[model samples]
Target: MEIKDWITLVVPIIATFLTALIGFGVTLNKIKREFKYTIKSYLYQDIKKLYRDLYVCLEKVILDPMLAFEDRYIDELLNFKPDIYLFSSKNLIYCYRDFGTYLFNINEAFKHYKIEIDYEDYDYDDNGNVVGVNFGEDEVQEYQFKVSTYKEENCPSSKELKEKVENILDNLKKELNMV
Candidate 1:
């Protein structure tokens, strides 16, 4: 009815609306922060798993005495490429490139070695008496093989790549405030 009465009603309504709006904004912000943290955690875990897979493949290819070709290693490495490219940042992409280069160089070095097999002839007496064995030079044959006498000095060490991945994980943890 009067101005003072109208003012009183309008002030309480405005204050109530403002309080509700502020409360909703705070709740929304909290939800956003939680969502962001969850997403980051998932991403960090995925990246770590990818790095582990790559590391295992490289180690097997570089250290295994029986590994003939790098086909399996290359396949394992390439499996993570799309994920790295799509979900990772620039720094991670660079690290992946460095890892890929190391693998390529190791594979190339392994290609240079060849496998040679030698046959031996044994002499026997008429009474089945054992004599000596002869390994003539002519009995040896060399064939191109995928195996490598890979010395540790020939390729990048796993420690170096591991440190790089750990550094990336550390950075991610810092960014997410998980550390």
Candidate 2:
């Protein structure tokens, strides 16, 4: 065959190959973006729920220590930690670490102080009658002291945790181009 004939045959083959390659690349990139978006969306939702639940748990601890401590509050918090390590940024991981450390300190305080709750007591009416059973002074004072300590010493940590959660969410939004 002549050079021209050879050129024409090779040119179409090359063009078709190039076109297919480009299309595959584009499709691959689109898939990657979508996959990334889906994973990040789930991570964002989990983190948001964790943050809100942490706040609720903290509030519950303050308002009703007996009910709060009796439940699986800490276990619920633990459920989100592995996700932080797997999908979150380093900063977010560090923030979570700080929060965890704060929790550990609180737990240690409880253990060191030997804070125990006795689920027994009396209810005094306006007329000073024992209407029902409830927590006595020691238990009440212990909880009051815990509330005071949390308010004084732990509020800043809680605020820091809130800021960290907000920062992480902002970072995630930026990554997803939602910002």
Candidate 3:
């Protein structure tokens, strides 16, 4: 091809590459913002339910101490197995049959961001697929399970603490009634 023809063809190709790069940068920023907002909204809803349960638990404990797990806690917990997540991050939970019933807890798969994680940036798998999510702060959620298990020690005499946690958890369970 002549010099003018080569220049015409190559210049358009270069322009297209530059435009694509700009578009990708913009898309990245938008995704980050959207991910952050969605995480925050979900986290806020969870927190609200958690706090409400705490309030109820405090009321129950202050009013009555006879509300032990055996009375209604076990059955209630069995009915509503809750999946607890915290901050603006994606955390998974796993369970396996131990003896008879399944014991539930947080999934440590995302343990790299165990203490601290950023909700936006994450590492992708070799297949160019998103693999993990990270959050900024190393936030820890302390759930006060009302049931007095043989394992956990009581830091406070407040039976209400347990009830408070339970109430919040139950509410959360209902919220996630689907998945």
- What are the models' TM-scores? 0.56, 0.47, 0.36
Mind giving the per-residue lDDT tens digits that candidate 3 earns over 1-179? 89999999999999999999999999999999999999978977876675455345335533543333232433433332342333211211211011003112211222223323333356688997878754334322221121222123322235534544444445544455532
Rate residue 134 of model 1 by lDDT: 57
Q: Model 3: residues >4 Å from true position, as ranges?
A: 66-70, 73-179
Inter-residue clash pairs, candidate 2: 121-134
Query: Model 1 over residues 82-102: C-alpha lDDT tens digits?
Result: 976886677767776766666
The C-alpha stretches of model 2 lying farther than 4 A from their native spots are: 64-179
* lDDT (Cα atoms) of all candidates against the true structure: 0.61, 0.61, 0.44
Clashing pairs in 1: none
Q: What order do you get sorting by TM-score, best first?
A: 1, 2, 3
Task: Name the candidate that leads on TM-score.
Answer: 1
**Model 1 clash number:** 0
